[model samples]
Target: MSRLLLLSPLLLFLGLAYLLPLSGVMLQSVTTPEPGLQNYSAALGDPLVWSVIWRTLRVCLCVTVLAVVLAYPLTLLWLKGNTATRVLVELAIMIPFWLSVLSRAFGWLSLLSNRGLINSWLQSLGIIAEPLTMVRNEFGVVIGMMHFLIPFAVFPLASAMRSVDDRVILAARGMGASRMRIFWQIFVPMTKSGIVGAALLVFVFSLGFYIVPTLLGGGRSVMIAELIYLRIFQIPNWGLAAALSALLMVSIGAFLVALIKRAGVSTT
Candidate 1:
């Protein structure tokens, strides 16, 4: 009874803040502009919608793979490096959290645009006469999303890596296991949970990204989130927008459940 009383305020808050809005979205998806599942059927049947879904999935997969590949080395540094090195690595991961998403989007624009610093430097060094088209495309969107997500991937990986038993690694070395052999055969297997957790975290995060895709993609790279915006504000198709929102919410919820299950297993 005491615990129930203590939790009542939070339950009420969630009911108002989350459950209310979600219920509205789900209801709107079916009931808005007339009753039925027409919105969902229309969304699933459209070729353009399928294309956007495919593009979003592709971008998310690319970002997740890149984050895992890049974050592994950094995770290793965080675990094994000296104090100063670890501090620098941690600062690099954390500083972005202080900046606004809009600010980071513009920062990438300045560095990646055709007339940006990178192009200017390359041209000055006679690397190429023509500027590279980096922004306003899928390439640009992937780069921006990856930058935002790598830090998220790193922490999970670091947690997983920290749980690994060092004695097992040393024992492998004592048996004349090469560094590469031990890493591949022993280190990676023990840290598989972290890698899986990080990949899922990054992929799920990439799914909901709107600001970076809108700015960096320059209207050419249309992701599902942007499509939802277009359906809502641009075209005033509330039913379709609500349907997309509900679908995205359901997908993310499924991922969150998987993530929780993974964490529980890791803890056990």
Candidate 2:
């Protein structure tokens, strides 16, 4: 009775703020246009809906891979770095989290625009007479997502890499193991839990992304979140909106379950 009382606040909050609203949306999916599975069936059967899902998955996977590849190297360097170097690297990794997402999106816009810094630098070097299209494309979307998610990958990876014993690495060095062998064999295996956890976090977050894809993508890359926004506001189709919301929730939950089972990693 005491334990239940202690948990009542959280339970009440979830019930009032989250569960109630979620239940309304779920109910709306079936009840809005004559209660049945028709909304889901129509959503699942649509080719355009499938295309959005595929794009979401692809961009998310790309961001996760890029973030992991980039962050893991920094994680390794951080592990080997002196205190000052570690502080600098930690600052670099964490500074993004302090900024607003909208601000970051606008910053990327300024950098990746045709007259932006990168293009100007390239043109000054006689690289190309014309500036390449960086913003309002799939590449731009991935870049935006990566900037935001890199910290997620790094923190988990840093925690995982710390679990690898320094003595084990030294032992491998003493045993004539090549640096490449040491990394592939000894270092990689030790950080599996962190990597998997980070990947799951990245992929799941990317699935629900709205602002980056909307702002950077310029409607060229329509993910589920953008689609939901359009359905609700532009078209005023509550049934379709609710259906997409429900589908997104189910898909994310399913992927999380499969990933946890495959990796045998616990979030706890």
| Per-candidate local distance difference test | 0.91, 0.91
Q: Which one is best on TM-score?
A: 2
- Model 2 bad stretches (over 4 Å): none
Instruction: Give the clashing pairs for model 1.
Output: none
Give the alpha carbon lDDT tens digit for every residue of 1-268 in model 1.
Answer: 9999999999999999999998998999999899999999999999999999999999999999998899999889988999999999989888986678899999999999999999999999999899999999989998998888889999989998999999999999999999999999999989988998898889988998999999999897889998999999999999999999888888788877877786664544
Alpha-carbon RMSD to native, per candidate: 2.2, 1.5
Model 2 — which ten-residue stretch has the worst lDDT? Answer: 71-80
lDDT string for model 2 (1-268, tens) is: 9999999999999999999999999999999889998999999999999999999989999999998888888887777789988888888877888898999999999999999989999999999999989999999999999999988888889899888889999999999999999999988998999899888878888888999999999778999898999999999989989999999998889989988999999757
| Residue pairs of candidate 2 with colliding backbone atoms | none
